[model samples]
Target: MKLAVLIHGLLAITPAAAFAGYSLDVRLDRSDGFYKVGDETVCTATLMNDGKPAVGEKLRCTVKRERDILRRDEFLCEGKAVTVRASMDRPGWLFFGFEIIGPDGNPLQGEGIFKHRMKTTIVGEIGAMYDADKITALDSRPADFDAYWASCRCKLDQVPLDPKLTEIDVPRALRGKVKCYSIEVRCQGRTPVTGYLAVPVKARPQSLPACVDYLSMVWQDASRTVPAEMASKGVLALYVSWHGLPTGKTADEYKTIAQTWYEEGGKAGDTDRDTWFGHDMYLRVMRALDFIKSRPEWNRKELVVRGGSLGGIQSIAAAALDPDVTLAIVSVPSGCEYNGYKQGRDAAALYRGKEAVARIEADPRRAVTLAYHDGVNLAPRIKCDIYVCTGFSDELCTPSSVFAFYNALPATTKKFMSTNPRTGHYGTTKNTAGDKRLSDIFRSVTVYD
Candidate 1:
C-alpha cells in the first residue's frame, strides 16, 4: 500500500498584503487491495509540502477492522520520505487511514479523502484436507507404546514438577459450596505456570477426580472466574492458563503481555524469536498437564482437559500428547492444516512464505513446523474419550476446522455436537450443554467405588 500527496498554491489580493500559500495534498498507493488472512502487507504514504518536501515530521497510520481499531503505527518522517508497513495476523475486514503531522505538531491540512480498500483471501486447509495422509503417516510411525512413556519420563526428569497450592480468595459466586485455590507449577525450562483449582467444599479431599480446564486465547489469573454451576455438580475444576497466567498487576500489564507475544516473528526456538507468536503456546498447555499429574490432591485416574477456541486447541493437543488425561473436550478450535486451508492469492497474503501449494507440498517442513502447533495434529494422538463442539456461524475459527479435527480423532469414544447456525462466536453458553454430556460420559466410563 502507498500514499502520495501534492500541494497547490492560492493567492489572495484582499488579505493583508499579497498573501500566497499552498494547501497540502496526499494520496496512497494501492488504495484498494486484497490479502490472505494472516498475511502481512506493507503500505507507504507520501506527503509533499508546497511542491518541495516536508522532512522530520511525524506520521501516524491507524488501521480499523469493522468498528474496532486494530493497530496503529507512529513514525518520525525521514528527510522528504516516510513509509509505514503493517501486517494483519488474523483474518477479518480491515480499514486503514493515515495522517501526517508537521514538525509544529499540527495535522497537515490535505485535500484528499485518504481512503484504503481492503480485501481478504481465505487460505490453508482445515482438518479434512489431509485426513487420510495424516492417518497413514501416523500408522507408519509405530503405534504409541510404553517406550514412548519412558521417553516422556526422561523428558520429565529435565523439568521437576513443583506442586504448591497457594490459598486465594474464591469468587463470591463460588464462595459457599466450592473453594478455589491457585496452583503454581514449574516447567522444564523453569517456566512457571499457574492455574485455578476449584473443589467442592462438601467433598472429601482424598482421591477426588479432577478436571483440568484450559483457558481460551485470553490470559488466566487468580481473579479469573469459572462456571460455579459445574463445580456444584462435584467436579474439581482447574482452569489452566495458556499465556502463562498473569501476576497481580495493573490492567496495562495484562494487555501488554497479550499483544506483545505476537509482535514480530513469534516466540523463541519455533520460528522468529523476535516475533512472539506461533505454536510454542501448545507446549505450555502440555506443561500445565504435567503440573496437574504432579499434584497429589487430584486423582490421576479421572483426569479431564477442556477448553474453547485456542484453549480448545490446547485441550485436544494435551490429551493427544499425554495419555494420563482420560477425557478431552474442545470447542471451535483453531490452527489446522497450513497448505490445505491457505489457498489462492488471498491465502498467499496470510503467509510469510511462498504462495503455491505445490511449492509447499514439495518441501512442507516450513509449513509443517508451523502446523506442529495446530490442534488438528494433536487430536488423532489422543487415546481417551473426546468431545467436540462446532459453531456453524463461527467466523474467527471456521466450522470446517472444527469438523476436520473432530473427524480426525482416533478415539473410539469421541462425540460431537453442533450449535444452531444462527449462533456465531460471541454466544457460547449453548455449547456448555456438550460439557454436561461429557461429564456424564466421564461418570459412566469410570467404575468408582
Candidate 2:
C-alpha cells in the first residue's frame, strides 16, 4: 500500500474517536461472533502509520484470561499482519488488545480492543461471561423470603404517600401545555423518595397511564424527559433517584451529596433486612409506585417500568412487588445471582472482592438476609410482561446472571430477552432489532388498556 495515497485518500479523518496518531485494528476469524469451545480463533491485528504498514515496528498483543497473557514480537507485525491465536476451555467472552511500542519504551496510544465469543453451541447469544446452557443460580432464597417482603410491604403501606410537587419551568419548546414538577414523596423510612414527576395539565383532574424510568449511578441527572413527553401521550411519568437527594440541585451539589453516600455504599449493608440498600431501594420504589397509582390522574390499569444497570434492578424489583405494573424493561441489570461469585462464574467476581465476602460470611443469617433481595428471587413474582436486554460482552452485569434471572420467571409470565455479542456494559449500539421490539412493546402498551 502506498503511504501517501493511504494518508491522503484512504484514512477517514476524525477529530478524536480513532487512535490519537496511528490507525490500528483487529479482526477475529469468526464473522458470526462465535467459536466452538477450545477452538483456536486467529485474531489478526493491523497497524497503519500514515496509512502504510511500519515494517520494523515492535508491538504487543494480549488476550485477557484468568491471568492476562501478553506476547510481543517485531517480526510478527512486519508483513502487514500479526496473528494471535486464542481459545477458551469454557464458554465466555475474550478481550484482545494491541499496542505499538513507543520510543520511550512505553506502549503508544494506538490500541486494538476487538473482542471474541467462545462458545459450544451455534445457538443463542455468544461471548457471554458464563455458559448460558450450563448456567444455574445458587438458590439463596431465604425460607421466609415471602413473609419478610410481605412485612416490608406492609411497612411501606403504612407510610403516608404525602406527595409534594414543586413545578419547574419547561423549555418553551417542550412546554406544549404539559406540566413538570420536582417531586418528593414520603416512603418506608424518613429518607423519602425524590424524582421528577410530569403530568398533563387538565381542565379538571383527568385519569392517565404511567411510565417509570429509574436512574443509574450517575450523579445529578437533570431534565424531566420521560414524564414531560409522556404527558403528551396521556401518561404520567416518574423518574426517581435511588439515592434520596433533592432533584433539580446543581450538578456540583449533587456530586457532593453522592460522595457522602459512598460511606454507606458497599457490602456493609448486609447486616439484615433493615440495613441492606436493596431493602431501602425497593421499598422506596414501591412507595413511588403507590404515589403514581394513587394520583387522581392515574388510570389505575397501565404502568410501565424500565431502566438500565442499577436502575434496572429497581425496575425489576418494582414490577415484582407491584402487581399494578403492566410492563417491565430491564437492560443490563445488576442484583442478579450474586451467589454466582462463589462458583467462580460471575465475570466481575473481584469487583466487591474479599472484604465484601467476609461480611456475608461473618454470619450465616446475613447471607440469608441478602437472599430475600436478590433480583432472581423476586423475578418469579413479577406478573407483568417483561423484556430483558443484555450484552454478551458485558463483564459488570454478566449475561449468565441475566439468563438465570430470566429463566426463573414463571411460565405464565410473558417475557423476552435480547443480547448483542459485540457490545459491552455501556456500549450498546443502536440496534434495529431492539428498535423493532421496543416499538412492539409500547405499541402494544397503547392497546393493552
Candidate 3:
C-alpha cells in the first residue's frame, strides 16, 4: 500500500566552507526516502566542489540506526558518486553520515586564499524509515496516572485565576478589524500563564469559536502578532508561551531566564511526580484553557489546541487532560514514547543518547516520572478529534515513537496521520506541491470560524 504522500525534495547538504566551495551532498535512491521492513535503499554521498564532483577526493562514510553505528567505510570520489545500501529490520530510522578525509589520514580542511586552511569537515546525512506504523510504546502507563493528574487539578483549582490583560496596539489595517492584548493568568506554578490574546473587534458574544495555540520550545518571547493574525480570520485565538514567562522582554533577557530555568529548576525533583517539571507544564496548559473559556465572546464549543514539535506535546496534553478541548492538531511531536530506547530504538529526543538512556535505566523512579509525561501513555485518554503529521526521516521525533503515540489513541477517536517521506524534523522538503497540500490541511483546521 502507498502509506503516505511522498514529499520529494532536494537531498540534505552540508554547509559550504567559508573560504572554499567544498561541501557534502547526501541523497536517497528513492526520492520519497521510505521503505518497508527488510527493504533496502541506496544512500549516495558525494563530495562536491563548487557544483561538480570533487574528483579524486577521499570520503569516509558511516551508516547508523539512529545513533547506533552500523557500518563504516572509505571511498574515493573518482568522478562518480559513492553509495551505500542500508535497511532496517524494524520500525525505525537509518542514517548515512559522510565526511571528507585528506590523504594525510585526517579529515580534509578547506584551503583559503591566504594559505589559511580552516578545519572545516564537509559532513551531511541521508535518513529514512521502515514500517513506521508498527512502532509501539516500550514504557507502560503508571496505574495512578489519572489520580496523579487529578490531584494536580485540585491544587490548581484552589488558586483563583486572576487574569490580567494589557491591550496592545494593532497595525493600521487591523486596528478596526481586531484588538490584541498581552494576557497573564494566575496558575498553580510559580510563573503565570502568559500569552497574547486577539479577538475580532465586532465579534458577537457567544459567537466566536476559540483556539488555544501553543508555542514551540524556544527561548524567545511568544509572537505578539500570531493571535491577531488568527482573529482576522474570525476566530477567537490565544497564542501561549510554553514557559509561562512574562512577555515583552528583550530576546537576550528571555534567553538568560530560559537558560537559568533549564540548568537550575527545569528538572528539579524530577524523580518525584508531584514536583516534576511536567507538573507545572500541565498547570499552564489547564490555566490557558480556563482563561480562554472565560471569555464572553467564546462560543462555548469548538475549542482547538494546535502546535508542532514541543508545542505538539502541549497540544496533545491539553486535549487529553481537558474535556473541553474539542480538537488537537500536532506535527513532529516530541515527548512521545520517552522510553523508546527500551524497544531497541532511539527514544524521544529529550531522552535520547547513551548517557540519558543509561540514567533513566538506572533509576526506576525516573522511568515512572517519564511515563506520566509520555505522549503515548496520554494518547488513550484523548477523546477529541486529532490530526497528526510526521516525517519518516525525522531524527528528533522519530517516526517510531510518533507512531507509538498514534497507535495508543482510542480506536474510536476521529484521527488522521499524514507522512512526509523525505522530510526531516523541521519539515524541509523540495516538493512544493506536497508542502502546499500539508499547509492546506493545517489552515482548514486552524482558521475555521
Best by lDDT: 3
Q: CA shift at 396, candidate 1, in angstroms? A: 1.4
For 59-173, candidate 1 gives per-residue lDDT tens digits of 6666544224568777675545445444444433343445665567654542321111110111000110111112211211223333443465466558766666766676575
What local distance difference test score does each model get?
0.50, 0.64, 0.75
lDDT for 395 in candidate 2 is 56
| TM accuracy, model 3 | 0.85
Q: Which is the better candidate, 1 or 2, if ranked by TM-score?
A: 2
Q: Identify the candidate with maximal TM-score.
A: 3
Worst 10 residues of 1 by lDDT: 119-128
Can you rank all candidates by lDDT, best first?
3, 2, 1
Residues 216-330, candidate 3: write the lDDT tens digits: 8777778778789778877889999988899999879998887767644366666877677766877898899989999998888778788788888898899999999987877
Off by over 4 Å in 3: 1-6, 9-25, 101-123, 263-265, 426-449
Clashes of each: 29, 0, 1
Q: By summed lDDT, which 10 consecutive residues of candidate 3 come out lowest?
A: 112-121
Give one digit per residue, the lDDT tens place, for model 2 in 1-449: 10010001122212123433454544556543345566776766666555556567766654553223334333335747677776667654555545566577665541321222222110111232324444557787878777888898887777788888999877686665678899899986536789888876661244566778888766776358866766655567788887767787887888887676644564445667787655677788788888888777767677888778887888889999888899887887888876666755552222245566666667876667667778889988987878777765465677667777877888788876665544546535222333454456445433112
